[model samples]
Target: MRLDELPLLTVLIVLPLVGAAVVWALPRAARARARTVAVTVSLLELVVAVAAAGAFDTGDAGTHQLLETHPWIPAIGASYAVGVDGVALLLVLLAVVLTPLVLLAADRHQGGTGDRLQHYLALVLVLEAFMVAVFAARDVFLFYVLFEAMLVPVYFLIGAFGGPLGRWAAVKFLVFSLAGGLIMLVAVIALYLQGPGGPQGFLTDNLTGLDLPVVGERLMFLAFFLAFAIKAPMWPVHTWLPDAAQNATAGTSTLLVGVLDKVGTFGMLTLCLPLFPDASRWAAPVIIALAVVSVLYGALLAIGQQDLMRLIAYTSISHFGFIVLGIFAFTSVGVQGSALYMVNHGLSTGALFLVAGFLVARRGSQRIADFGGLQKVTPVLAGTFLVAGLSALSLPGLSTFVSEFLVLVGTFARSRPAAVVAVVGVVLAALYVLITYQRLFTGPVRDELATTRDLSVREVWVVAPLIALMVVFGFYPAPMIDLVREPSLVTLDQVGVPDVPGGTVVDRAADGGTDDGDDEGSTR
Candidate 1:
């Protein structure tokens, strides 16, 4: 078969699942071998993902590449379909790339060994497969199935392997997730019922073109948006995240916040806007308002957090607020920025969580007040923490700055008041990060902390890629920006909104001339 004809996506989704099965089948006594196998398999999956990325046609950013389809559940008009556009590909890469790092970062104390070691590894691999499938699914039904199903391994990873309150946190996470899933299920069924009634009816393209009653469309939009917002963990519905993050292992928290949580905003981008353009626009103001509130509320909460894990979780809430804000603004820069923010947030937040996990492991506590003058004993750890913290604060030299800047500028063009209010979150971010750093890493060295060691070679390897990517993308974000441009335009077109001139003008002017570069100056 030709390269494009190969079932690359299916392989990408199945490989880890198969690996999980193999890990599970191993003798329980072979926990060491199982860890090796799991890590090796994750590495192999990352290689496959990179090969797929290499083959992706970046020049044609609007179309899904390497499309694969087969008949599955014809009774429900659902087919086994998968493909990747720039947006999907980026997310897939994120999932694949993070899985291995998370596995490698796993230590015995964090529930990486024992009789359940194989089970933990298997569940992580299974979660990886579902995450890839969720991002790659071209069929709406398939997306929803994988969307809810993705929760299974995560539930186990947390409830079975997490901290003292793991089971309770897991239950809370599941309850919130299931409530959202139920709401989305109603909307999905209603949408399918309203369709022309065939296999094609379940496809995203076909569903996008459907003409439904205004009230029906709005209701469906709410169903999907509510689910996504909760997943995004927007304020009010966001309480579960702090508990979940605090209780889960750092590696688990990394995947939960970095990759899985993204599914929520991803749904908003891929499902809500395209499938219900009028409803998206109709609901933009309210969503933007909520997003702004999340930005401030999350930041304020982060500053007050006593637990390091919970603090990082709160920061994600703030970051996600910016992402949702950009998505709803309906401007080219805003949407593209949100897309890029998804990628950047994964890297930065994943690093912070992992580092925080290391600190907790060393100090035997997650409380910020437990450590003082850590820089005197473990300079490397303190330095790594500083880098990750600065990145979270959107330091200008980091990858986050570019995306966050775009989101703010884009929102400013569409709604100055919203953008202005969102900017306060930035100041709050700096306060939280610096204060946490000061509380833990600064001050006189304590005799107890003097024995604490710095990062190991393995730990360094885990964080090295994330730090490198942040710096590289910070200076040169064009490649990612180019990939996101066409998708943003397509979304703007669906929403029937022209590109806001202020965004375009500011972007162009910042680049030092009127030339529009590879995007051709068109926002749909």
Candidate 2:
């Protein structure tokens, strides 16, 4: 690549590190200085991401753009390869967009006169850098490295700044993540052993050639899937999320749930489909069944939650189910819709967290019962919450509704029964979000909460952009579709799914048919 074409990937990864170092070197006494520096760095990263998105060609939707490659471990044939397709670019953009918002949210708690606040700001900046890198890294090892490296900042964020459960929540989060990483490690090693040519080992390039025996592929695929599923926090494995989220401060919860958790779904799309297509095909039914269960289970649990933070946590699991279902469905619309869901979900959910954080700061509690008639005292805040909640529940004209609708439509084209069941999830979501809004915001102001004030100008700034983007993207998603169509096509072929005009539309069981990778929705 020409010097002018130098991959933006390294820039995306490096900018936050530079921001972090600058924050650290600044005098610990300079809390304002550190926050200033961190916010600037995050916004700059956002600009770069937007530029990268502009550079992408919507027409060549499937190709990786702004590519770069350099040999990192010659002996093992591994290289530091990084690039973004439309789907990856969308995720990269979401990470970039949320970083500044996260920093802004963190600023709300920095009002206390303490020098130690600088360290908190610095860690958030460093985490932003790693978050961007995680989405952009094409090399599996590089991806894994960033994945594991990100835990430290968040661990400290929660442990140091969280509520009474800080230490316990942090430890639980790490234990779950580390255990999953080790499982994936073994799979990565096994993949290296099944090298494409000679003993060169498992660089993604080489592994692309060695499809591996079906049995071995299935085993390794499950290993990686297990790790990512936990991160995705799917139904059975999602228990960690509610505790961690509830214990952490709002800013910390925003980043953890908004950007970091997405790493799991990204892995499934970028790694699993290309490396273990056959196994992915073989496990399709079970995965889809699990995804459907998550949708219903999470929604039901979310509806019953008394704590707002935990309610949001359970709701996220439900949202993740939509993304997973889209991926396993294997249709182009399903895959692309899944990717879009990632971005849209980040915006809506992140906004909710920030808004909730504002409430928590005011009332010093997260209990739904602790809030009432917030609409009267804090109408702006209540309105913001309503918008975000509606969007989260996939209200029409919002970004999430478009993606969720497309996902069900795509899945239905292949498996009508599965689509019917998933639609019930939509109704459940509406019930939870609307009822929560009514009970918390519309009722008569309680004596305690009535004293609560509306969001200040600065707090409003923190959430406005996120809510705006949620609406902007909802009505005009065609640009996003054009950008990712090609990549989704490439992934579909990789996973043994044949491409039709919109996506694969199959009439019967996808497994019994020829395994030319057609019938992408085999999981249905």
- Name the best candidate (by TM-score): 1
lDDT of 2 by residue, 412-508 (tens): 8767777789889999999999999998888678987757778888889998998898888888888777866788878877776664455445633
The per-residue C-alpha lDDT of model 2 at residue 104 equals 73
Model 2's alpha-carbon lDDT is 0.82
| Model 1, CA-based lDDT | 0.89
lDDT of 1 by residue, 1-524 (tens): 66667788989999999999999888756767887899999999998888888888888876888898788888888988889889889999999989988888888867656766778888999999999999999998999999899889999999999998999999999999999999999999999999876865688877886788999999999999999988988987999999999999998999999999999999999899888877787788888889999999999999999999999999999999999999988788999999999999999999999999999999889999888999988998899899999999999999999999999989998788899999999999999999999999999988888889999999999999999999999999999988899999888887655677745433321221223444554333
Which candidate number would show the highest lDDT if scored against the true structure? 1
Q: Give per-residue lDDT, candidate 2, residue 325.
A: 90
User: Which ten contiguous residues of candidate 2 have the minimum total lDDT?
Assistant: 507-516
- Note the residue pairs that clash in candidate 2: 62-486, 62-487, 496-517, 496-518, 497-517, 498-518
Give lDDT per model, in order. Answer: 0.89, 0.82
